[model samples]
Target: MEFRQDINGLRALAVLVVVLFHFGLAPVSGGFAGVDVFFVISGYLMTGIVFSRMEQGRFSLPDFWLARGRRILPALLAVCATLLLLGWFRLSPMDYKMLGKHALYSVTFLSNFIYQGESGYFDAASQDKWLLHTWSLSVEWQFYMLYPLWLLGARAVSRHPRAPVWAVWAAFAASLAASAVWTTRAPTQAYFQLAFRAWELLAGALVFLHAPRLQASPGQRSALALAGLAAIVCSCLHFTHDTPWPGMAALLPVGGAALVIAAARHGLWLTGNPVAQALGRWSYSIYLWHWPVWAALAYYGAHRQPAAIAAGIAASVVLGMLSFRLVEQPAARLLNRSGTRPRVALALSAACAAVLLPAGLVYVLHGVEQRLSPKVLAIAKEDGNRFKDRVACEFHPGAADPLPRCVLGDRKDVRLIVWGDSHASAVVTAVAEAVPHGVAYYGYQSCPTATGVHYRGWDNTCVAFNEAVLADMRALPPQAPVLIVNRFASYVFGKDAGNPEPVPGVVMDDEPQLSTRPELEAAYKRRLIGMLCRVRQTGREVFVLESLPEMTVYVPNHLARALLRGERPDDVKVSMADYRARNAVVGAWLQEARTTCGVRLLDPTPYLCADGWCGGSRRLQPLYFDTNHLSERGNRVLLPLFRQAFGGLGARKLAAQPAATGQGG
Candidate 1:
């Protein structure tokens, strides 16, 4: 198969977009699509080479395997080993364990599946993951593993002459269409689905099978190449996270790449360009090595400026050339010459398994708890068992157990009942301390203690759970000082069901308008009034902890970066006034309830926001566990405010209190 310099330049374009986007460059929100473009190009080139050889009776599985081993494994192994060693020295035990697990998955080419199974990409845990980029490599490798067999079959079907190409092309088209639909309905699957991505490669393969004449004169070829380059550039600028991805939206880059590759550049203007060709030559190695280096730099907070990122790109290219010359080219040549590719591969595979097996065994033997100090482990237990688990129980079929199941306070002379959803869990430690003598808590995830409004698309099982929590609250034994606290955004944004799929920026209609402020506020007010009235009817003192102001900045992530740079994370806190302004409607609504609905508002804005700032902190003090949830220490700091409100309602005093301790994470 003849090499195309234009395709290598296309790879440079793809990697450029992804790198810029990762560095917080605004214009390239959709830069992640570069991976998709590579997939198509890879499919095309690999298929073209394999199928062409098979047609000439020159196909050899051993040779093919040797080629792939030389191309992929060495650079990848270098990166993984370096990252693992670095993690062992500097990362926390939890992070180190996670890195080990990530290594295990990466070595096996299954990281994509593992991550998809664990959580959606939007989750907090995914934010700090260093090997998250490997998921795409896994997807590609999985394809490499399967695509060869399909090519052999295509060769077998060549008795019908054109039938094989047509069949393959048709399958690719069908898969592409199915992937487009699935991308919207189940994007997580769409992101990792091998079948959906096959069409991109197939499009490339079709170009290879036909090798149709360009028919364009030199000038026209140059014009087409320039146009293709323009399309690629525009796509990087215009795409964003909200954009429907790898679906119809992916056509711009994929098609542009196809145009550049197939145009075969008879024009001296493009084909003769030395820099483009050089970039093209090392493009494969550049792609293989760049991300991991950027990942390490980003992890360590080394590269952020445009100049620095550009330097990283230059360094990547330099390293790529060296690697292509020394490691990749030599290893491939040696393996092919010696005919020991499989044996070498088996040995490498064994080494990986040997390293990974012990890591897994250690992980299991210690359990996940070995990562943290005893106090942190205790806090984590409170996070999971007491709140996350039990609160999930409130909305089903019966009342939650009236015992303060997960609260961290002393278990004696129960006085108050904390009621609502997982927002209550954020302050579980505080609640435990505030009520002491164990407050009877009633809460559930996604189930607001409200009636008349039913949420759709939630699990059928949750219908009973919702009814149960409401019933339990109704039966609460006239406990005064019943506190109703919840993260208000859920009610406003219709969070009872689940997060809505991110609507891409290119949508033609008014879906974004559907999630606007008025609709959310109206829903919030309705739920609040219903809950407030019901609690007051029981002659219980109802205190509504209006939702705490959420920090708009992704504080912990920012802090991690700052910490790596030897700066205090607290140097970056934004003002709480900003938060108040954003939630003025909710605040005003709370004020109205205080005046008209006889609901006492326990606004703790003062405790959280000093000098009108309501943001994250890093003063060796925990603030948020993630975006919206409070950390255990953050909750501990607020216990005094909670206690004052509960104490005012004649709440029972603490008895047999457990000593609360704090530990370094």
Candidate 2:
């Protein structure tokens, strides 16, 4: 295949958008479409190579696999090896374990499946993952392994003049349909899985297979090329993290890439630009090295400022250039010069095994925590053990077990029913520790106390669970105090009040009729009012626990990383003003409920924050396991406040309470 400067320019464009998006640069929210562009480019180039070889009656699977190994392995190996060395010193034991697992999967071309099973691409924790970008490479490599065989089989079965084209189109249609359906039903899987993503490459393959018959006039070609560029630029600018991706939304960028490739033979200006060509030459290395650089800067707490980000970008560019020159180019020359495909393949396999051996050992040893001090290892271990004691008491949505055990006092009388989301579960530990009366902990992940509202990406079972909890509430004894708690700001104002945009996987449940923030808030108030009325009708007392001050950073992970760097954990505390701002809307609602429905409102902010700052840790012990959920020790610190909120339950009654037995339904 002849070198297409336009294609190289396209590569430049793709990598630029992806790098900018990763760097937290604004206005490129949909910059992730760059990966789709790369997918199409891979499809086009691979198809051209395979089809041309097949037509010449000289196609060899070993040769094709060897070429792919030479093209991809050298740069990827360099990145993996570098990350392994850095991660040993920089990452916490638990994080290092995860990194080792990811590295092991990545070396074996299985990172896509691993990541898909772990979390969504846009999740906050994904930023800490050093090799998250390799998932796409895994998907592409999986395709390469399958596509050639599929093509050979199709060629053997049919002698029709257009058999190859028809086969490609059929596969494209099937994969596109799967993408559309799976993106909505199982977005994380659709994003990472090769089955749903194959259509993108097949779309490019269609262009390659039909190139001979795709001729257009110079004027037509110019128009098509410009339209394609516009489509790409528009999607990159307008699409956001909230957009349901690789569904119909992906067509704009994928089609744009196909159009650009199809029209490049006719001389498009953008694809032939000098800057584009230069960037294109380094695109692969940039893609490989940029993410690790970003993740490392983030781990070191240097990514908060623009100067640090700029420095990281500059470093990425320099490293990319050097890798392309020093590693990728020479490795390719050395491998190809051998003139023996089997020998090259065997050598590449040996190199891959060499890398995987250490990665596997790391996974087996569970990150080798002995490298860190006992104190640091203890902190890292707390991440997994934080909520283990409370697990039996907390029930998941859709569970069919009997109600959770409510034992607390010696008398074992159920007087309090804690109901809300995961936030409530965290508080239950504190309430259980302080209150003499038994408390029934009825908490489900992401299921808020409000009725008639639904989070966009949450399972429908949350609605069922809320209803079940309401039914359970009706069964509680008269005058039982129902404690309601949640991360209310997240659902109401969304991360910030001034910019109340709906998060990607969280939207109004009402279909075909999206509700505005005010509308949703009003609906929530009404539901809460009705719930309060029902509880009061049963003569039960109601207490609404105000949402805690949310931290700007996850305390445990951030502090651990900071400790590794010998930095003060206190430097990352959240401001009181920031907390107050985020909770303003929910605080007002709680006030309204207190006034209108006669519910008692308990404010924990006074206990958690003071003197204009909300500290994330108390005496060097992390207050939270993550950004919001309080750690066990942190929760124990809040026991006195919880006791006071329960009508100053006397010390005699508190003393009468037995030690927690850790029994549950």
Candidate 3:
């Protein structure tokens, strides 16, 4: 396939926006759409190569695959190996372990699946992820691995030259439809999986298949190129991370790339300029190197600031250029040498094994904790001490309920029903120890205890669990007390910007993504109050938890790092006034609810915050299991609040009760 300068310029544009978006350097919230652009460009070139070779009656699948391997593997292996080396010194044990796993996945081209599985509100943030950007490369590699076989299948079905063309278009439509449907239903899978993403690439194939018929005057070509550039730029500038990605909205960037490629205006200023051409030439390496640089800076807590962002961009570009010069060029030359396929393949395979063996060893050793100081390692070990037993107690869309878990005390009488999201689960033991009654914990991930609100994910619905809990409450005898614990501020304002985008919530049974909606706090308050009043009407005591102060970092890992750096772990604290200001809207609603619904409030501030600060750690002991969920020790501090709230409640009934029937936690 001949190189088109316009296409190179387009590559330059695509990588540039993606870089800027990640670093947050430009007004390009939609810069993520740039990957869609690259996908289209990839499809065009791939299809052109395969079809042209087939036309010449000399196309070999192995040769084609080898070419792709040579083009991709050398630089990929270089980056993975580099990260593995530096990650040992730079990352925490858990983070390094994660890198090892991610590196393994990236090497195997299965990172998309692994990353999809790891997606959650509770997982590590993007900047904490070194190879997070590799998921796209994984997707592309999967596409490469499969697309030729699909073409071969199409060719096998028909002798006509146009068979694969028709087949690809059909597949393009199906992929697009799957992307649209799943973008709403299963966003994580839709966003990361090749099935949903293949259409964007196929759009490029269709453009290549039909480019011959797109004849136009040079002026018309220029206009079309400009329009395509505008569309791509608009998507970057207009859309945000919260946008349902790779849905129908992705067509803007995909189509724009296809149009620019189809226009074939090699000298157009937008794409064919000197800078664009240079960036284009180094695009793959630039894409590969930029993320780890950003991730490293992000891990150090300095990224997204002006100096850091500028330094990161400069570092990424320089590293990319060096990688191109030293690694990609040398590998290309070696592979292009006469009859070097076997040696090249063998060498690349050896390189992969070299990376895989250590990465696997690192993962097996759990990030090799022996390297850390004893104190930091102890802090690292505290991370997995979640308050609740996740396997049996936690509820997700399809999580198994093999036991009567979350029943913290005697099962004879479930005197108290503790309900909310995961935040509720975090403090269930504290409530259990404080009360004499059998505590039935009804905690679901992401499902806050509000009647008119719905959390978008969690396998599409949180309806059945909440409803069942409510029904159980109604069936209970009068004067049954219920405690609701939720981290309210997250849904309203979102976690600190670098964390996963805030949970997309449907408030008042209306629009989703509450943070974007108008008067969301007020709506959430109405729904919450209504639910509390309804419970009260059923002769149940409704106790709602005041907002738990959100943490700026993962407390355990932050403390461990502080220890590792010999910095004071106590320095990592949330401001007391800031916490109040952050939760002002929810606070107002809580005040109104106390009068309107007579709900009892249990404030954590009195127990957790003091001296104008809310400690993420308690005197070197970590309080949080993650950014927001409390560890067992962390929630134990709130025992006083729970005892006070449940102190005046009547004793449990001693009447014969239903047998505790399931497996125990």
Which one is best on TM-score? 3
Clashes (backbone N, CA, C under 3 Å), per candidate, total 14, 1, 0
Q: Of the candidates shown, which would achieve the greatest lDDT relative to the real structure? A: 3
Please estimate how well model 2 matches the true structure, expressed as its whole-model Cα lDDT: 0.78
By lDDT, the candidates rank as 3, 2, 1
Model 1, span 1-665: residue lDDT tens: 66556676677677667666665678787778777778878878887877778778888876776566556776666666666666544444445556777767876788888777764344544535666777877877877777777766765767776656776787788878988998886677777767777787777887677647558777777777778767777778888877766788888878777777777674444444677666666666766667666765655656576776777777877977887787777766665565565677675566566656755753454324554445334432332222344433343434443322333333244466677667776775577666545565655565555543333323333334434444544433455357778665444443311242222111111222444455544654665576577667767677788877665434443544344345554533546755655456567766776776688887767777777666555453347654566766566657778878775544434233333121000
Q: Between prediction 1 and prediction 2, which has the larger TM-score?
A: 2
Model 2, span 276-296: residue lDDT tens: 777899999999999998988
Q: Candidate 2: lDDT of 609?
A: 80
TM-score quality measure for candidate 2: 0.86
Model 1 has an lDDT value of: 0.62
Better of 2 and 3 by TM-score: 3
lDDT of 3 at 42: 93
lDDT (C-alpha) at residue 277 in model 3: 93
Candidate 3, 434-512: lDDT as tens digits: 8886777777777767775765444334556666667655544455578888877766666552343443354445545
